[model samples]
Target: MTTAPTVRTSTPEERFVAAFELHEGHTLNGSNARIQGLRKDAIESFKQLGLPGRKDEAWKYTNIEKALRHEYRVLAGAPLDEVALENLAPFLVPGLEAHRVVLVNGRFVAALSHIGSLPEGVIVTGFAKASEAHADLVNTHFTRYADFTTDVFAALNTAFAQDGLFVYVPKNVIVETPIQVINLTTGDEDVLLNPRSLVVVEQSGSLKLVEGTHTLTEAKIFTNAVSEFFVGPNARVDHYLVEDEGANASRIHNLKAHQEADSYFSTSTITLSGDLVRNDLHFLPDAENCETHLFGLFLGKGRMHIDNHTLVDHAKPNCYSNELFKGVLDDASTGVFNGKVFVRPDAQQTNAYQSNKTIVLTEQAQMFSKPELEIYADDVKCSHGATTGQLEREAIFYLRSRGLTEERARTLLLLAFARDVLEQIKIDALREHLDARIAARFAN
Candidate 1:
């Protein structure tokens, strides 16, 4: 078993801290002083906690300390040529009628975005423009959902939350088409980028959001991204996160959501590739009669490491939640899944189920899975389990006997294993897009 590397020096983290400390003064002078106060408080909280390390339980398996040892250039409104986006043609999702928002090096680029016929009450704007144009919405819900007090990376992101996407749906309104937010990172030197998003759906409102990350350059990049969602009573939202960043990058994504009574919230994360990636997904069923579901799939190869940590907090009575995460690792890559379902004392009659399944093709590839449930209520039905194994040898042999090549047979079985979760994605074009990506992944 290989162990996490030791932190050789604290200089890199210290420089980041210094940079953030310097940002506090500027981040607190906005039109909404309350938002500034919130930023100030967040920076102070981050100063106290610093960055997470191997000592933290939630980050025990992720060697964040060692990952940040290398020097990184933090870009501020970096210049990106419009012509440079031609290389990103392969990442687009064709046949999808959608409004797209583009960001380069974590900054919004209006010239590159496609803003379609968005109806009234549907606020789709850049985080900066929305912060100024829709002050009420930004001031009211921007920093309310994610708990940065306990999460260090979240705090860091919030402290540096300059540009991203803001989607808001008013009561009784339904978004006509899906909205896609594409974040593209590019630079010459090693860079650290933080992209933040806030989404709010009012009572009886509905929407579908697709968030994608793509790297356009070969520079080493580290991304700390945070997104928050508030589902009002009876509202519905389908959220999707697709991570296709380049090979030389590290990514940490934190998604925090709170669902009200009778609300429906569903979120899925599809991680196709990365160097070191960690996803912290938490859902709070805070009111009665709510339905929540979480799904994730990660495929890694060649020294990559991916971890999915999820928590479902059932705080009210009579809520239902289902979760499943699957992974396929090869070429000495490592994948980890830790999911916990918590049914509080008052969360009686909560029906929650969690499961994790993984396949490691080579002996060098490793998968570690842990699924847990802690119930304090008596009338709750909660179950959790995890399974890890290699590709079924019999299935491979059967396919090979049917005139398929060894690599083709292996790819078929791998796709079969991931099909159950992929089918759950409701967007047809997106499903087809992911299918092509998966085939290309295994074609190598």
Candidate 2:
């Protein structure tokens, strides 16, 4: 018999703080006044907030400290000339024809990316170049959406923000081709990466963005990424994030969006593999007649840990929002879902709904689901609920009696259960790819 390796619970604050100090001058030497000021303030916030432990209310269910037991080399973004386009074949969605953007070790590599198919007004490039070329636009919306004062990971990512993805769509223009951003981690050393993205869609503009992460090496990689989106009036944005990493990878992702009147914003998060993964998603519908939607699906096995924390703020009258998250845990894996909807006092006629469901496949598997609604408006209609249980044995037995094997019957039932959230994905190729992946995961 083999025993699992012990994890050290020591804090990694000092290591990161030292790395920041060693690289501060190099990172902020030629930046503008506003950019420099934001970096300095962000580092101070990171120092004050530090890393969260079990005592933190928001982090009570996830043990992130245990996943930080690696001696990671805090590094900045750099182009990878060694990686070729052929190396990305396995990570891409099959049969999808879209403009592809590639990032290696959190830095955008233009040589490996293909974005010529996009329209004239659409702007897609690395954050570093965008900050220099389109300084005014980047400065206006960079740190406006994703606040780092209360969240430690967001603060850290802001402090070290250098290169990632930057997308812009002009007013009244529609982008027909989907923009795919692929973030890959390679190399044999343990390291920590901070990536940032800022997307702005002007009035009446439309866009479809897809982001994914994959690990190509067996080394431990910790990725802390922050993305901000500004949806203008009558604009539409569909965002998707897919995490398909190895057991040696851990990720902390924060995405914040601000929607104007009559705008539509939706996001789907799919977690397929990882050692420890946490997603912090926030949507603010600050104007009347705005619509927001959030969906997530996670499959955990082999001691994997997945945590999702989401907040939908209904600050204006007649706004609407809906959320649904589901999980399937097997072996000794664990999952956490904490969804919150806040309706302000002036948000009259606001309609918000949230639900979380989970299926535990083994006795040792666990799931913590918390759905909350805090409504200060008397005329608001808000509801939230959670459910966690196992697959119905009667259904499985009934399928088996129809000449199907027990494993096959169970796989079919699980697929049907996940179809609700999967069907919500708008991208046909991406949805089909995920369907095949999920089927293979259960068929084995």
Candidate 3:
């Protein structure tokens, strides 16, 4: 009989526990002992779960063990300086006066941010600070909506989440300006960046938020980020995310959003660069009359890997959801898309649609797309489709024959293909900013 070779465990869980304990002593001044206990519990949960491997269903496509095997050195504390701000200047939206919230290596940097005059009832601040200043609100919604058990990374984030952004918009308030979070990573040292964002829009409130991520250092790094959004009854929110990181970095991001009755939520994610990136989005329409729109674009080159997994759950009647994801794979890159829509038994009159399209720019590039629809109710409308193909050589040749350079022609065609998804972004300033970045990415 043949026996399987015994596999050795990499690192002890106690190492992470010890590291977390060292940081836990630095108490957040305004938070009470109970909230601190919750933070400790989160870290303990993460230590137990550790990092997910290929055996895990959600992480099967993008293996973290291979991408992130080295131990990340916890970054030493430092104030935000001009050099850090200069490194991030390129990512700032050109002409919009945005409310900037800056975080460096997962720690809030107040000096590097520009805080606009918020509405009377709106509150935007660091999560640790919010826990101290507004403990009740922070305690109520911090980890209330997300299911940490199913998502090990989220539990890890909650465990190591010491500093991050917290935004709360009260009932009937509309924040005309967009809240911009620029998460800058300086890879001068190896570090584990655990970034957490909590957004709560109360009944009838509205908000627009934009998040940009960039790496300043050339050293290898890993980013483990989690964001939770809550949309109250009659509230509406539009969110945008742009990630342009260094090619050697690895990123794992999770977005979990919950919607109440008569609420609306929309998200557009643009990923232009990264060595290995995995994005997981979950939308739960818990009440009736809820609507959601999710769109994503990923452009990769030079052996990069990008995976996007999305789920829309219709638990109540009369909810609607629309999803579209597109990818452009060049060189030897790989792209994976898995989108699932579930309509519960009680979700009568549910409407859901999903589509994934990919353009392979090189013979070596690969793409895998799976769009699934699960409908339990008898009266429901749900459909899903996916496609993978090479770029249209005929169109490229036609453009080239019209006096356009081959490179420029290809860039223009790719831009046009991506425009359909970019145009869905409601914020004009952010849209233009992203367009410029996309153009610049192809210009090289």
TM-score of every model versus the real structure: 0.94, 0.96, 0.92
The candidates, ranked best first by lDDT, are 2, 1, 3
Candidate 1 local Cα displacement, residue 356, angstroms = 0.8
Residues 1-444 of candidate 1: C-alpha lDDT, one tens digit per residue: 113665545565577777766655554245466666676677777787887777987778888877877667554445654535565476679987788888777777777788777878798877777788898888888777787787878777877777778889999888868898888887667878877788999998999998888887788899988888989999999988898888888899889898989999999899988899999998998999999999898998889999999999999999999998999988999998999999999999999999899998899998878898999999988888999998888999999999999999988888888877888899999988888778777767
CA shift of 6, model 3, Å: 20
Clashing residue pairs in candidate 2 are none
Index of the highest-TM-score prediction: 2
lDDT of 2 by residue, 289-363 (tens): 999999999999998999999999999999999999999999999999999999999899999999999999999
TM accuracy, model 1: 0.94
Decoy 3 TM-score against native? 0.92
How many steric overlaps are in each model, in order?
A: 0, 0, 3
Question: For residues 231-251, what per-residue lDDT tens digits would candidate 3 score against the true structure?
Answer: 999999999999888997788
Sort the predicted structures by TM-score, highest score first.
2, 1, 3
Candidate 3 ranges with C-alpha deviation above 4 Å? 1-9, 12-15, 26-30, 47-50, 74-85, 401-403
Candidate 3, pairs of clashing residues = 30-132, 42-159, 43-159
Query: Which is superior by lDDT, 1 or 3?
Result: 1
Error of 1 at 70 (Å): 1.6
